[model samples]
Target: MPGLTFEKLLLIAIIAVFVLGPEKLPHYAAQLARLVKSLKNMASGAKDRLRDEMGPEFNDVDWQKLDPRQYDPRRIIREALLDDEGAAAPVAVKPPTRSRPVESAAQKRLGLAEAGAAAPFDSEAT
Candidate 1:
């Protein structure tokens, strides 16, 4: 049913008539119809059994809300990380501040300054 439109069904029927021939086609077609009907009945019977086992809870359940297809990974993670009231708490951001560079003795010996500018070099030190 998903991919089979009326035109596609007609084309398949035409091909089947040639391949199976008119006499055997009817028999196969009837078998196919029975198979589809049985499958539908099986699915409905399963639902009915589940409903009977669950009682009133089955009817009360929100099927759409419980559907796996409706879930989003990002949204689920976000909701889990949210506060108790369901609203997302505002995040406090610290303002960017200029931090003083820590210059080690080795860096100073190498003539590297705090601001990354090269210190005055003595030719003899090399």
Candidate 2:
């Protein structure tokens, strides 16, 4: 998730100058500029299409809430496990115990917890 800072961009530009040489640098730079402009146009076109199709409601829409970056598996599972009445009672998750390993629905389906099931082997893997 690290972003390209000014220093990082400068370093890359310096490296590209040596690698590409001065002769082809302008040509590649123009191509890169064109690519960026085309990407912008495409994005704008999509947004315009969506706005036209959705009408006034499009402007009122909460874009941040629709972002995929906010998705978290643990948060989703925790929310799903919450009680209907919103009580403080703990969620009952039956994980494999130390004394006796229990086969969960997922484990059973994956054949990982099946009795007498041998580990998968490939002769050529080694």
Candidate 3:
């Protein structure tokens, strides 16, 4: 984009003037103007065709809501496939429960802990 600045465009024009002398420069400039105008017309035609095909509903749809960042990951993917009516059930994340008393592996190997006793890690071993 920076290359399209006024200074760069002037540099390009100077180069083109040298390459295609004064007599041909004007002709090529006119051709370039026509090319740019035709490209803009083509883009407008495509947009008009889309509007015709989709009708009024095209403008009514909420494009921002359909964007993925607006919804939870699971709900968005599920919604795309029409797999559910209600929002996806919230996923619960927690550590696995340990019912018995806990001890470090080093404590058991060295016979340093009694049964059913929670022990801090061995400082030296750690």
Candidate 4:
């Protein structure tokens, strides 16, 4: 990384220009690019060969599901909590219980006895 600074880069360009000359500098640069590409391919191939020799144990990787960019801490926490508490129960689709309709005065009186629940309605009957 340090070797690829602007000054080093300029120096390399100047040297390449001087050594290869202006006429052939472009050609040599293209050759250098091709060499770098081939070297990269060779290095990667070597890594694969090493892994192959090391057997399936070395290459026992799950590459499909792995990607650093997809990491999500909140999702992980939610999943862990759900698992810890056993699989989450299915959400109830029903509406919340509403106030029960008062039938007779006796039922209304009984409901009122329960306290703070249902207040007695002052209807014509009352």
Best by TM-score: 2
Summarize candidate 1's per-residue lDDT along 20-110 as a digit string, tens digits.
9999998999999999999999999999999999999999998899899899999988777774576656789996665787777977887
Higher-TM-score candidate of 2 and 4? 2
Q: List, residue by residue over 1-126, the lDDT tens digit for candidate 4.
A: 544788998998998888888999888889999999999999999989988888877668666668876779999897787788667677889966748543567656576545346655668975
TM-score of 2: 0.69
The alpha-carbon lDDT assigned to residue 110 of candidate 3 equals 71
Arranged by lDDT, best first: 2, 1, 3, 4
Candidate 2, residues 57-92, lDDT tens digits: the string is 999999899999999999988777774566677679
What count of clashes does model 2 give?
0
What C-alpha lDDT, on a 0 to 100 scale, does residue 14 get in candidate 4?
A: 91
> What are the per-residue Cα lDDT tens digits for candidate 3 across 1-126?
544888898999999999999999999999999999999999999989988999998899888878876779787687776766675677798976887657678888877568755556788995
TM-score of each: 0.55, 0.69, 0.47, 0.40
Better of 1 and 2 by lDDT: 2
| Counted clashes in each candidate structure | 0, 0, 0, 0
Please list the residue runs of candidate 3 whose C-alpha ends up more than 4 Å from where it truly belongs after superposition. Answer: 1-3, 61-126
Model 2: per-residue Cα lDDT at residue 114: 64
Give the 10-residue window scoring lowest on summed lDDT in candidate 1.
80-89
The residue pairs found clashing in candidate 3 are none
Can you tell me which runs of candidate 2 are displaced by over 4 Å? Answer: 86-120
